[model samples]
Target: METILEVLKKMEKATAREMAARMKIDAPDALAMLRDHEDRGEVNQVNGYWQLTGRASKKPANAVPKKTKPPASKINEAVLVKLLHEHGAMTSEQLAKLADTTVRTVASTLAMPVNKGRIVREKRGNVFHFNVVSKTALGASKLPESASKPAIPVTETPKTASIPEKTETPAPQSSTAFVDTIPQLVSTNGQPAALTPKIIAGEIRKTKSRLVQLEKLRVTVRTQTRLQRSLGL
Candidate 1:
């Protein structure tokens, strides 16, 4: 009987007489039912003890199975942009090394829409380098030409040079005074004058000496003013 079989399963291994005693059934009937189960391979007999077979002991076929979850992506746009900003421009291999992932992963993440304007790629030498696009550069690239530089309208005509009124020219000064005013001996267009380091140094020294003289003159003038004020002159 099913009651006798349930008792046998709970006991793990039991003699047919023991199962009958637990189920309160006749020993003969319990032995006959156990013998039928053994023939059907649902139970097995080792020596005089009977036990449920492996197939009969398994969980029911209708039980729910655990579902397998999908793996998550390891890299994203923010992570790649952060790395580019911290390290400046870098190749795919360099980024991969710093991110602790594969080059393909870095490439795929950078190709997404979220990173479109934030990251830019340039080819230098034989390798492609990745850079984080600065806010200023991105905005400049998006600006219209007229917005960046004011455009002159074609309808507006530029003013022409005006004729000067007749006037008397000023008298010429001495060539010596004009020559002294020249800051340095610079090479003019198509002139053979050579501008050497020695010449530059000499000009610098002359200018410094002139500045010191001017400073001394300023101090002397201040002292003279103070003295005159104190003497009521």
Candidate 2:
């Protein structure tokens, strides 16, 4: 916390991103520390930048006191959710960098979201790459592979008034194997719920399109850390 306050004193305003970079910690960690200070009347986020308050204030600067780092226990779901939204997919090891926590911590924390369907974990090679749950998948999930024609949604204008208006569900595929793109889902009754139409036809589809640049970020951070060590920061 003292380290954070000192950094804040040097800068006019600092966003979570800037603070994280300067502190050589994860962005979520910096944000969490700032918020903790804010709750204690020591700091506040102003114009998207964290600013010091009270004893931690800029005027009549206080000495940067030595303090032990706090144990990381709290899991910031909002930060995790935001990261998944931006990157589309990431492993817990990669995600730990953004959260400024250990990979083990993230692995434990991700269980709830994965179980709840808020995050989908797909096994790529060995480690699971966590992706955001597609909120718009509802429309596409109802159709099976055997469906001959894509049903025109009720929202669209019909070509002719004489034509009968009806919504047709696709026949369920016999294969139970999960697809590479979207995994097949089953309901509580152990019945396969088709997903083809639910994923594609839905007006509100939210799937991860791009992979998170975790490796690049890790490389850059390592370089920065080495530089900081050399400078005795």
Candidate 3:
């Protein structure tokens, strides 16, 4: 069965009832189908009517008509930005009038580019001017003029210190030789010490376990925190 959207596409622009009659479906069903298609981003609303978005259907010979592009007077943000770059600076109102768009859009567009450092803002009295800061200007080195000041002279001072002779400290004598006559103590515990391969393998295993545990714990903690905040806990 042909969908309402297909029928609407063929008709170019149609209301719920018109689409329903063309598709042989009830008006409510047609409306529901149209809504679903719209929600899926397959179609769009023009004025108060629904129509298939983008290019018109070429399959149907009797397709109503293709949608005409909006006039050049309707200036978009990109075009406005380009214009601003071409021209020096313009107020939001002036840009809106020039772009044939709302003042809000002009303000928003200006904000994004300014924040990105692609353009710079300057204030003149009460008005603001946006200018594109050239890369050369930003990175250019500032060298002092030779005519400004002469370089200071470097001075060397003579050392007046005296030398000292080195002496070797004597090693400690065996004063504790009397204590060496006492018997030496020994441990009797038989616990097995960790071997080299076993120690290395154990360390690697522990590291892997810690990483996995940390990742899982991080996710769980985030989820729990979100849940707690949502529940006002």
The TM-score values for the models, in the order shown, are 0.34, 0.31, 0.29
lDDT of 2 at 4: 74
Task: Return the lDDT, model 1, position 131.
Answer: 90
Expressed as tens digits, the lDDT of each residue in 102-122 for candidate 1 is: 665565455532234567778
Error of 1 at 103 (Å): 0.9
Arrange candidates by lDDT, descending. Answer: 1, 2, 3
For residue 181, model 2's alpha carbon misses the true position, in angstroms, by 88
What candidate 3 gets wrong by more than 4 Å, as runs, is 1-77, 140-233
In model 1, state the lDDT of residue 155. Answer: 84
lDDT of each: 0.69, 0.66, 0.62
Candidate 3 per-residue lDDT, tens place, 1-233, comes to 55465677788897877876775545655665565455445677766678886753344777785554443243444686687777768776677777776554454455545655666778878987766667776544233465346778888764434334377997655734422322221113433333367765765787799999999997898779766766799
Candidate 1, residue 200: the lDDT equals 66
User: Which structure among the candidates has the greatest TM-score?
Assistant: 1
- Greater TM-score among 1 and 2 belongs to 1
Give me the runs in candidate 1 sitting further than 4 Å from their true place: 1-73, 113-115, 153-233
Worst 10 residues of 1 by lDDT: 65-74
